[model samples]
Target chain A: MLERGEVANSWRHERWDSFRLLTPNWQSRLPGHRYEGPDPDGYMTMAEVTAFIEGFAARSGAPVRTGADVTSVRRAGDGYQVTTGGGEFRCRSVVIASGACNVPVVPPFAGAVPGSVEQLTPFDYRGPAQLPDGGVLVVGASATGVQLAAELRRSGRPVTLSVGEHVRLPRTYRGRDVLWWMDASGVWDQRFDEIDDLTRARRLPSPQLIGTDERTTLDLNALTSMGVEPVGRLAAVRDGRALFSGGLRNVFSLADLKMERLLDTFDAWAREHGRDGEVGPPERFAPTRAPERARLQLDLRGGEIRTIVWATGFRPDYGWLDVPVVDEKGRLRHEGGVVDSPGLYALGLPVLRRRRSTFIHGIESDAREVIDHLATVTLAQRPGA
Target chain B: MTTVANGVNVQALLDAREALKGAPEAAQFVWRASSKWQDGVHSTTRVKEFFGLGQEQEHKSEAVFDADHPEVFAAQDNGITPIEYLLIGLASCLTAGVASVAQNRGIQLRSVEAALEGKHDIRGILGVDSDVRNGFNDIKVTFTIDADASRQDIEALVAQSQKRSAVFDALTNPTDVTVEVA
Candidate 1:
């Protein structure tokens, strides 16, 4: 991110603050802290998360089982029995956490490109170091876009990220994590069942702040600083080059100017909203934009980029297990926290109680509700005593 | 055949796929088979290419065997057989999902198994079919999630597996198959 000009002003300051955090871990009477993302908010670190999970498991007495291959599960009269290589273990409920990617979305044109044209799915992505260095294009533009573009740029790879519409947020605001508001405000709290799936999936306006009360950024300046040109959406991938849409009519330099103008427009809007009593100013603000259906086509196409990172986001896969809990389009069917199947349940799913159901922070709250329900349902299933 | 749904002339995709031609070009992946699972099952078999970037090629091969015929057998690559590899991947993926979710959820699973059955209407594969169902109709995966998890739990597991398995993604989310004669 620092390489890509994505750091903006916030990153510049964090670079120094990072050393301060390292001091704590130095055993200076206090614990040494790794200021994980230059974000000053001190959101729960990986260590904290691990500790929490360990505590929860110890409290619940659920023995941690790893790499145990379970063959099947059948009903044992009132309860259930599970068969695994680790031997049979009984459980009242289950939370299937098989991450989505059930199927590789093998694009049709993948083979159309020359054999030399390397292809990889986000599913296969490990890191920027692994990519065959050439001007690279990343296709999707959801959370994956901003992060991948920043990482690759730092690695000194001229990278282009092709993003569709997406929701953007900053790392912090008013000394608090942007996630704080994203969760508290209804912006990320709306339930998926409350709206149509289309509305649920697309991006929307948000109060999520960016880096500590410092400065914020959009992708425009970031890609340019790393010499990672921004090309339009990929139309087709040929042998040596990929065909693209938008801004091809003019010189590539003109494209960069367009990004600047868009950022300027975004800042101006934020200022206006701040004054208008609409969206208030955060202790800090991140450069961001909500996909405007109107200005979208009208907005001048920005500079040409080499690759498109499909950070466009993820989709759920349900092809092997046969259950009717899924609806017409193949997503699980559930009302709020209740699932379609009896003695079966799901939680921490995207858009469950609200749009935030899928967010990292929201998962904690969702898990609480789910575990509670599981306890209740398990007791209910006990032979109508 | 075309049908109307939601007032749109929806080409029956399943039928169109049935009508769709398989690989217009004849290409194959032939490996030397060492031992036979089936006696008459040709020690050497062929994989017909249905679509996407490959030369118009025919595959043929001989069989290689270990010292003990009854002991073990392996096929040496004539070349990369993408389809065969994909089929194996699909089967493996479905089975893995079944097992993983079962364990994570605390479901006592005795045995989880899946069988892959591919359906490629001859017309679709040969490009002779006026009706399209170019790809396999259904890759049936019968998940024998042991007998432990209730029929309900097992069924849900199966559904979750099917819903979450990536192999199924490769199958259902058919990538655009663009072909050009270079």
Candidate 2:
């Protein structure tokens, strides 16, 4: 297999200093390598995660070239031609598993922020110590954004977190990890084809969750209680000032409502399986507290915020892909990992094969399915077997 | 025969959506309204022509409405105020969405009513407080829906309606408005 740098390079480089797997250690399973660590319920730190993946690669004994950077992949004859910095290889099938988070997507108004304020995406962010000594504005309230905001606030950096539409999920629910419930309740195994609105499901942002020893829930409300100022989505930047949306209350309401619905689903599942007696009673969280009048704008030139960390989102970079399967928005047009073009496939994308496809434990089933389809195609293409 | 459910023309709506998918440019609609000053704090707005389907079209009939502030504002009590019109727009948009979504989901609706209240602190508009905003502080929409389905299903309909409502999105999200004096 091709390796850009090494096994689990993103886990090594992209994650922050204290980053940990959002899922529990027990969910860290591959085809054969199941996590048998002592802390099954605990989260794996960045170092442990890299070591785990590197161990998998070693045990699997897959021939991997570490530094072979792929330059282009295009159709050649009946097969495909993959050209890399080191060499070129021809194969009948190819699985593009480079992953979805290839490049950071900052808004156009990001350029309008005064040059005096340092701008960085989560890729460049390591920790609060790497930032200048002042308040920080962390845009986007997904897992990465909320984690950074909380971390920075704890480090004594005044933080203002700009929140957009985000899924609000508790780290644990009713004496069990939320991911465990999702797994046991068959929610995570929901196939992509079974969903009505796959487009919307795929476009959804990551939930506002964090992994810690205590399994704490890090939502906007939690962030607010931690003294991190909660603001609406960043709308614009004009004349050295950053403008935020005025729909903070509605945004919070939407997230809370959705979270309630999910928890209700979990409760129903528990009752149906007669497991309610085993777990804690169903509980509800307080509604997200929104300020009556959230500040609409912040003066960037006033020297209050010295750094702006954009945890907005990421998009795939397929500039090296010479296939026409990419849509106008650069998203790969695929149906359950089966690309529109023959002899091509994808892996490690949100909702690619199932709802759990983006999780580390989700890869085995997706790989099996893709390989099954490949076997069928290869057999059909063979001469008169 | 046209497929009608919950008083919504389901077939036509589906057909239009399907047809527009093939010709996306035709789906770009430019809604228009022109208001003329009638008197102090009053105006008459007319809605007739709009651009859609790659051409300008009429609404079959011209609709005119008068807007004015209440007597508390020391203005002539002509008709509903402009802010009230925004409430009307939001309510109607969501109500229409509820009917359409319910029809699509095959849910028979008995009654669907939406009560909307927009709380606005006039201090900002009156130039008394710069910290206050000129728009409503918050808009609350309560849907009292009686349907053949369960309560959960009814709530889902309203939530889905809000998710798909154009006015709801425009109100909750940022929209760029460029006004120029020519």
Candidate 3:
């Protein structure tokens, strides 16, 4: 979630409805140089996404059960039986769409928060339905950090944003949306077996910092324009103030390291492929990488910082999921979403391809890969199939 | 990252610079890549710095083979590289030595394979501090040899390999890696 949060429309001019574009029109002109799908089928509004499954039931006049939790899953000979809070459903094979950001993660920070301040994650944030009228200190600098910085500032919140390893996405390349190169490169192209390990590690693209206005640095400018103070990494919070690593009066660390690693991996990848055929690309030739030259420092010792809004990043919690698909690092072990364990599939996780696993626009290819790999087998085949 | 208000000390700098002009030349040596001799022996000697990569991102590397010409194994993980292969050769040489000694004594062999990897921190190699470099680091190897030979007989083979492996000799007593720069 923080992965998308940091770069999701980081540009300034991009309103919430910018990606809602379904057709190729002039309105997308300001949306940077490229789009995964310039001619989208339709823009599914937030309401549409929420009501999609419910609306299907409503249209069919079927009685539906919402908020039902799964209890356990077991292999029943050919097909597996899935037990839930409501009832059990049996299927030949099950598709697990539990996204990486599905869980509301709370980092076990060292200190306690003050009662007077407000601290909420992007997960709990439901469209500013109930926001306090106090000053705001937005922790984390990725997509959510920047977005919340913009959102609160626009809504008259005295927001202070702490900048961490802020991801950089080019606004345009010869006047095209950044998404164009992604599509053209093997970033979304499929050649699973042929990809080398180093290339896979270094060439995978990361979603760059997208300003709301498509012009580069628009997101950073937007928050600063709206008076959102960009601070440093968060150290701790006590009373109603904060502290910063830069020896500021009080502040916090903006992002979590895991989130930064995901972004940095992309930086390494863009450099590896020497994006656009530059000799000694960033990944190959260390000097080409922007991060290599960046003298970034995070001093996380703030004397006065209040609430720590952890938009750090999202982690997929597969606790209740009693599956043997994950490796020691709590990540799925597979090739293009094909698990070593039978009758299981994962979707929307990071690093699933040459660079395909990082974006919503690119996730569909993985979905197709999973569906294709599973099509040939059935319940009558493997023991757990 | 804190810069001093005043600039650097010029007298201290000039003295340091002048002292370096009279320094002796950097060491040099011949790097030979030799195949195993008739007795099945090959040796290697590397400086501690190059013995193992430190936790330096600057030294990041991955092995790549052309897709059209596939090899036995290709990866970028902690797998052994060409130099590491010397260790493998040493182990294999030991195995061969043991087999030859035992084969003359009528012990048969079925199969033999050895996979090994070594780990060491760079700070130790550079000799930043005596306490820091620490000790032997670690070496892990899984040698699988199948034959009609019993465990007692294999013990003799192990001893022979340890005694005759020339690569192991260099490891026990490593010659320094010569260094020079223009």
Candidate 4:
């Protein structure tokens, strides 16, 4: 396997802070034996996680060519030409595990926010200590946005959060974890085809939940009450002034409605299955108030506003692949990770097959399917078959 | 050549800008409104709005704003409350700013959504606490703009609009007010 960075799971390299997996421990996600380590509540730091993967790789004796950044992959005679930073390797088939979070989607405003005001994406962010001393504007209030904003606020810096439309779910609803409830509710088992709006479903932002010391939920309301300035959606920036939208009320309303519906669904399911004890009582709904400023323009030039961290999420970049399999929107069009371009395949894409397809626990099924397809195709093309 | 896209007339805007540049006095405008107290917490403000300065034709329109409360305060359940009117005024002004900016920039916007929320502590208004302010402690304006342009582009447009907006300026900065028997 050709690895792009020096280490496995290169995305986690820049992340200096400690975090636990959204789901359970390594043992549950990765197939096979047991993880005979400090399995304290399943949550672990990046260091511990990387060590586990390295140990797995060592045990399996997998020939991983690290630092091999694949520049392009083109079709050869009967195989494929995999060009990389180091050199080239001709292979029969390619399993593209580049993962979705390959490129950070920084909005255009980052460029205009004055050279003095530092702009950092989640990919570039290390920790709070690395930032300049001043108020920070954390845009795109999803998983990274809320977490980073909280972390920074804890670090003794004022944080202004630019909220977005996101799915809000409590980490622990009843006695059990929300993930457990979702699994029991057959949410993960839901297939891509079963979804009414595939595009919308596929593009759904991850639920606004945090799994740090424990599974905790964070939303605009929580953040605002916690002293974090929950502003409207970031609209524009001109002449060192950051402009926020006037539709914050609607944003809060939508998020609140989603949360209500989600909890209601879970409640109904619990009642039907006689798991009422497992489901907790209803949460009091308090919508976030939109600021009075119809258009909020914060002066970034004054130096009070130092850093602008964009946690707007990421989109996969498949530009390196020299194949005609990419769609107009720059996404790989595939049927369960198996593309129409014979030997080429894409794995670890969200909504590839099931809901958990792109997740750590879900990638295995996608990989298996791709491997099976590759094997079948290879066998059919064999000389004496 | 100036381009026109969203609801903005670029040529007309350019002409206005040129007109303002040639004669700065013509750019000045004044808006007037008269209000009468009905009862407790109830007042009616009559607005015969007119567009002044540099225009060949005098434009006029009539509008009314009635402020009242439900059971909370001692007033008949009438039109939207005064604070609500303030929010509406701010919302409408900003929304106009967004539309103007989008149009001026030639952004083919799919939809423009704007909302305003104000946080208030009634202690100051009721004279329960001397420290508490009489108005909204903080107000938040949120917008969800679906446009062909990038998020940054739209944001920049909004910022420019805020800097240029009359209502935005009036609220953020204090304005001199004079009261006398008329």
lDDT at residue B118 of model 4 (Cα atoms): 86
RMSD of each: 21.5, 2.7, 22.5, 13.8
DockQ score of the complex predicted as candidate 1: 0.01
Candidate 4 residue-wise lDDT, A253-371, digit = tens: 66665666677777788888888864567555565565554335578898777899998988888889888888776788787788867777878888888888866677677778778
Which window of ten consecutive residues has the lowest lDDT sum in model 1 chain B? B1-10
Model 4 ranges off by over 4 Å:
A26-28, A33-42, A278-285, A288-295, B1-182
Interface RMSD of structure candidate 1 (Å): 17.6
Predicted candidate 1 versus true structure: per-residue lDDT over B1-182, tens digit per residue:
11211221223433443454354333232222223332322243334322323443333543232221221224343332334445676778766666655654566555656666655465775579766555554444555557455665666556555556666555544335656765
TM-score of each: 0.46, 0.93, 0.47, 0.67
Q: Say which prediction, candidate 2 or candidate 4, comes out ahead on DockQ.
A: 2
Position A123, candidate 2: lDDT: 88
Per-candidate interface DockQ score: 0.01, 0.36, 0.01, 0.03
User: Tens-digit lDDT track for model 3 on A269-361?
Assistant: 556676635422232111111111111122223423333466676666667566677656466666666666677766666656435564545
Candidate 3: Cα lDDT at A94:
67
Candidate 2 residue B93 Cα shift, in angstroms, is 2.2
Candidates sorted by lDDT, best first: 2, 4, 3, 1
Question: Where's the lowest-lDDT run of ten residues in candidate 3 chain B?
Answer: B47-56
What is the alpha-carbon lDDT for the whole of candidate 1?
0.46
Task: Indicate the residue-level lDDT of A84 in model 2.
Answer: 95
CA lDDT of A275 in candidate 4?
A: 82
Q: Decide which is better by DockQ, 1 or 2.
A: 2
lDDT of each residue in A156-267, candidate 2, tens digit only = 9999999878889989899999999999999999999999889889988999989999999999888999999988889889889988876676677678878888999999
